[model samples]
Target: MLLLFLLVLFTQNYFSHGDLIADTCKKTEYPRICVSTLRSNPDSKTADVKGLVRIILKAALGKANTILNQANDLLKKTKDRLVRQSLNVCVSVYEEALDEIPEASVNVGTNNFEANIEASATIDIADDCEESFSNSPFTADNNAVKQLAVVAVDIIASLG
Candidate 1:
């Protein structure tokens, strides 16, 4: 029974989601990222537009959380006061983002979905964190979250 359910679920996502995912992604700024990210999630197989936003937001939140953890770890290990100050700023900004993503996710299903401000805010948050350092902190992690947030903005705008 478990195997049967798994097989059925796999086929359902494989066949049904292709066109929907492609169609939706076409309306976004980052079509490739949008398509690949949505297709990678099993829940997205049956999810509509709003559901896709939630998935993207959740992924962004996860990435931000990881970046925060990394920053915190680096903060404890580094001796430079300047780097420490920058890491502190990144940690604060990321925490702000961490709070916002959940609210954005909840707002997805509510009347405020379109009114939510995270579309540009997420990008700003990532950019702000990046700019805090002289050289740049969490290079790869910062880029990843920024890209995810960009994808989120495109798709979230489509919701409007």
Candidate 2:
């Protein structure tokens, strides 16, 4: 009987159901902790944090729209050197960021990984040049290009 019990215990250890009880217990406890931690009082600073975050997000969106409108207006109205230079700077920074994506490749063989390793290096220098610098706000001469640049500017502004 002892030997049978030992065998059962050993088999139980090997035939794991992946600790579902423990996993569920951990997941269940977190939501209770979250609910308990929420501010009980409306006047408390902790309660006000969410309100503040909303306000900040709204303000940021407003500012981005204003700036984008101003940029469009300026680009349309003037051929001023300073405005052109600032647009150029924006384009330069965008292009630099694009240049930094890693290019990679992979090789697979039918026999084994060893055979794959022996095979020639298949190069894949990703020419993402169009995607990378495709977001320049100053490149919006045509309607489609202007739309693309506006979208990029909106994306960048939202990150702030």
Candidate 3:
């Protein structure tokens, strides 16, 4: 009897995790990316919606910080004044976006509306960064930053 009970409990938990991932991913614009990224994290196996958003937000922030660091490094390597200026702009914009992530995470617990707004603002910062390089030869970096921003936006929209 105890063995049967344990089997049932384990089955329910396993199915529940799958269901939660499906439900959560369905809410996002990029369902595939959402599912794959969240599933890669062990915590998502048991996290509720808010917890999942928090995780996504943290991941987005990490990406933004990475871009910022890359921009800074590029600035040091490039001697052209225009390229250095563009990289500096990217660094600053990413910094602002990174600042908003914690605020968004805080708001996620009690007010998803505010959290969404904050997240949307973060996306805008990324757009500004991309636009800053419109005439520059940094298309690859710009696209990479835009992709990260889109992921962050998709995660925010999922909170709805």
Candidate 4:
């Protein structure tokens, strides 16, 4: 009985953290991003699902801030009226997404599905930003913004 107990304890301790993270990541739409992001963060190394959700939310918020900053900076540099207009739209879209991130983060803690819906809407913001630059000379910028938004969407999907 003593040996059996010791073996069980060792196995549980050995597998619990890593296994928990991997299992949770598997549920996310972007498993690679989910696993890589969680594994890279020291705080998430031993986190449960709730903890992982918070970590992911934090990361998404940071990414949204980055997108917002990038849009603002681009708006300042470009002299083209059309490009500036498109970038302005991007700034507004990212701002809304940034606001949604914190609200979603809070609601996610309580298992609120509405938070997931709000978070998912962030993708539409990115799409609109990209569409604003359609047939314009801002293809690279559009792609970059869209990529960041995709990451946010993936993070939100994981929350659901």
Lowest summed-lDDT stretch of 10 residues in model 1? 111-120
Q: Which ten residues in a row have the lowest lDDT in candidate 3?
A: 140-149
Stretches of candidate 3 exceeding 4 Å from the true structure:
135-160
Model 2 residue 4 lDDT? Answer: 100
Model 4, 13-56: lDDT tens digits are 75788887777767655667777877888988666666776677
Sorting all predicted structures by TM-score, with the top scorer first, yields 3, 1, 4, 2
lDDT of 1 by residue, 1-160 (tens): 9999999989987777677788878887777777778888999978888888788888888889998999999998999999999999899999999988887777776744542576557778888889989898577778777777777767776677
Greater-lDDT candidate between 2 and 3: 3
The candidate scoring highest on TM-score is: 3
TM-score of 3: 0.85
Runs with alpha carbons beyond 4 Å of true place in candidate 2: 1-47, 87-160
Order candidates by lDDT, high to low. Answer: 1, 3, 4, 2
**Per-residue C-alpha lDDT of model 3 across residues 97-119, encoded as one tens digit per residue:** 87888898888867777887787
- Candidate 2 lDDT tens digits, 1-160: 9999999987786334223222222332232222222222232222232222222223223333443454556557769676655544434432332221111001111222321222111101111212233453423222222222222222222223
lDDT of 2 at 131: 29
lDDT of each: 0.80, 0.30, 0.74, 0.68
lDDT of 2 at 91: 41
Clashes of each: 0, 0, 0, 0
